[model samples]
Target: MQLLLLVDNNDRAFLSDINLYKNEQGKFIPRNQCIKLKDTQGREISLLSHIDNSDLYGAIFTKFTVVSSSRFINETVILRGTNKHGQDVFLGLLLDKYEFRSFLDKEDELCLFISDLDEICIFLNNNNYLGSGLINERSDKQLFIDLKNNMVKLKPKMNHKEKFCTSFRFFNKDNIMVNSIIIPVELSNIGATNTTTVTLK
Candidate 1:
């Protein structure tokens, strides 16, 4: 997992080969796990994390303290930020809605922009992703994904299957299911089309 940081000064920072530890008998234990990350500048802050790697959207991590340390406590590949949702650690990942998408690419981007079909354009909205540079602005958040377009940003990687399951169950842990939507975008010879419909009840 990679570690990404966002600074108050609008600088992005990153740390590869991120390590996590729990003070077991005054010894920091390293647990092998995978997560996503990026970086920014400001005072470096740290959190103790236990990343649960059982889903595709990303890991579910919780914070703990094993020692009385400064801001730097333990290291993990966790994405931290703030918005209307408040400060939280996000195991950031997009839903797998694109059939022609490769998981390897854009794995570094952790910012998520969830919308229904009403909006034809999805902007990266950097103001929303405070303190993190790992996730840059995206231009394509529309229902129609240009399959022939070589640029991956024009297409979305949102996973529709996880909408009711992983998304509802996981994000609800923090009561953060506010602005997120999980719709499936399927590609056809005619172009891109949404196979699922979302209705607010």
Candidate 2:
């Protein structure tokens, strides 16, 4: 089956195993096959499998968007992946509020919520630009702090805070590079103005 490995920010192997089915009340409940591993923050990570290897990789390779919402936080993230059909894969899902910042690391290594090599490869292979609208609705101050910390760890050269939408773009036609975040703003009298840009390099 397709395995979803959970890793720390350093890309180290955290948990590895497959998903198995157990008979329960005349039905089947899927269970994990490996032990849990703690990341740098002492958060437990696990490996999960949904389908067979053939289909798992293919589904994840599709481009998608990730949306995280909670009683106090709400945000959206978009990402793209590579697939065998020549059509880029796009994935979108909602994640736990604190989970996004679980991989923040200023050191030599960055942690990952998913550690499966195959899945990671597929995700990195099919890359594209993503954007986000206003984020003033977030009521979780801690979540914002953690997210800001994670952004710092990402090594963004320039970051801007504005009441507008922002998006990321990648220009790695020849070599792999970081995607940049762009923002467009409108002044009170002016038509439209462009504010600061966050370059991920």
Candidate 3:
């Protein structure tokens, strides 16, 4: 698998060599991987020298395990992963939906296009999936994707203390059903604080 990390609107870094191993559940997951930055001339470049105290850099380099992923019809994907520090980091990837499906045909050759790293972290941290960064803030609803079933669902902006429940079906690429997962989301807004809680049912 390939991981393309975009440094900015203009600069990018590519990690072409990645190792993936299946977990106990038989799902393929990326191993601990590091990125090597290079210029157009194939010369090594220092990523740290380009930016200081970058949350995007730390999130990408830190050891993390992907927990959940959601994709939109507009070819955008939101990934949630938990780092070694027990912090949930969010990443936004931009790629054609059809291209992503093609990647599913060849799981080992999947290429991930990650962009707007910093903004994704900030927006998702605040429980705002539809934010002004990589994800379209103009969107009226939040998106949820079932990768196994190739399905997508949307939820309207919730009022304070609103509760919502949804069922997600999981399947493998071969169209074999694995399991069904039910998620209950609660949105609580009190005094100046907004909190979103997700629980499995």
Candidate 4:
């Protein structure tokens, strides 16, 4: 496995100058790999790492040594790691709304979701980009995948106020009932935290 430190906005050069090693706290320590001390026989020895789940391919970036910035809060850093198959994956550690998980249907596919939508549209052109959904129930995972398929067509529902709020789903080709995400605009009064619990049927 190999690790790379990216410049966040765009893919940039690899940082190979900083020295790093595992510490007792499980975080990588820069410029300090080992410590010298006396062993049982009074002979000088090194006290090395004893932390579990230490990543060998991970790195430590000291502010003055790695970057000139005093803090990393404003900086966007992406850590890219490659597996044995030579496929690379990147993570924006400090970026908001950035998450990647294995696909619910296929192992080869990765599911990436960005979940911030105001209201459901009246009529969405088929194959258009739909917002993200968070499956609340355990059994809803497969239901979500089957409903959110590309072959399905979903339309909004007209509520008591004569407003199109909720969405009902149907198949595009076959009459088979395929599942999809539905949002009720009435109950969608989300708080300032910007969190919504989605239900899948």
Candidate 5:
């Protein structure tokens, strides 16, 4: 069992459970169930549903943090987690810009919709992005958000070379392309004070 923390554009946070099951391949996978959380009124509101091809691939984390942000030109879903396999996973979704600015500017309440498979698609006021990853380990995980370039990077606190896997997607009104790769990242002094910490047992 793992926990997923969802932070909406309004900065309201919701926590939900992520159930895992063993697949025919003898690997653990997350069930594609609708993620719901209660609002201040105690009404159950659906945050994410119709999740297709939900696969964690045995990458279990104590906790997962997801943050959704909409800027002038782009909407992003940032996922951060360190799995039990001693690997850091960073997933980001970059979608068409200005799609949600009108609604956001008006302070209208918007529901979040996430779909697709390995490439997770997130929707806000009918906009979407592809992202996936697991978060775990230490409490001092640092993340750098480069709004100018529409990128989010994790800076680990460990000293050795760590296995860092990333999948980032850029989607526009005309073109859609996804790049997924696993690379090793060197750990060094993290100077970014803006961070999110996930402490695992």
Candidate 6:
């Protein structure tokens, strides 16, 4: 996937290369990420000869915009941010439905805006991630997913052919039938406050 990212703070604007790859263990690894700036006339901003402080604290990642391909239409891209303070943050990506419709013809381009990175950090400060950042909520909630293990023998209730999928099954280990709509349960809710752990069997 190719993404054009523009990160801008009030005083500075920079462009960077964001590359994603799969490792030998079948895990996604991101690297070659750097930021550079240029003028309106397209002159490369020199990043050298500057005092460097590795401690990045209270640095707000504002006006974050990302544009990628149609292959990333419904898929979420995992993002990790290391602030000046050495704090790590996790961000989940959702394809902006409004922008998806507005830029259909240009499906190769996907855009997302992130206001405050800290809010996302607070939400995910405790959770672990599975492949592709598919998070499993640690509450008594289940989201429907098509799998071979939990299929039921009964006929499907829906009439629409497009709605019926081959891998239809119950949602959890207990074989609970998921409701029509899925509700997300977070750590702060229901007297539970812990990071959701993801373990691959």
* Candidate 4 local Cα displacement, residue 112, angstroms: 36
List, residue by residue over 115-191, the lDDT tens digit for candidate 5: 32112212322124233443343221232233212232322333323333333233322233332222223323335
* TM agreement with the true structure for every prediction: 0.19, 0.24, 0.29, 0.18, 0.27, 0.21
Model 6, range 1-201, lDDT digits (tens) per residue?
122222222323222222322233522232322222122233223221231221222222222222222211222223334443445432233333233223222322121222332211121111211111112332211212211112121122223232222322112222244322321211111236532221111
Model 3 earns a TM-score of 0.29
lDDT tens digits, residue span 114-171, model 3: 3322312121222222211122231111323322122222222334235656544433
| CA lDDT, candidate 4, residue 125 | 20
Off by over 4 Å in 5: 1-20, 23-26, 29-58, 61-74, 95-142, 146-148, 151-201
> Could you say which candidate leads in TM-score?
3
| Deviation from native of the Cα of residue 52 in model 1, angstroms | 26
lDDT of each: 0.23, 0.28, 0.32, 0.24, 0.32, 0.24
Q: What lDDT does candidate 4 reach at residue 148?
A: 33
10 residues in a row with least lDDT, candidate 2? 124-133
lDDT of 1 at 180: 30
lDDT of 4 by residue, 4-108 (tens): 221111211122222222344633333322211122242222112221111212232221100001111111122334322333323222111111111111221
Give the candidate order by descending lDDT: 5, 3, 2, 6, 4, 1
lDDT value for candidate 5? 0.32
> Per-prediction RMSD in angstroms?
17.8, 15.7, 13.6, 19.3, 18.0, 16.8
Model 2 alpha-carbon drift over 4 Å, by segment: 1-77, 104-201
159 in model 3: Cα distance from truth in Å?
A: 34
Clashing pairs for model 5 are 73-97, 81-134, 81-135, 82-135, 82-136
Report lDDT (Cα) of residue 30, candidate 3. Answer: 33
What TM-score would candidate 5 get against the native? 0.27
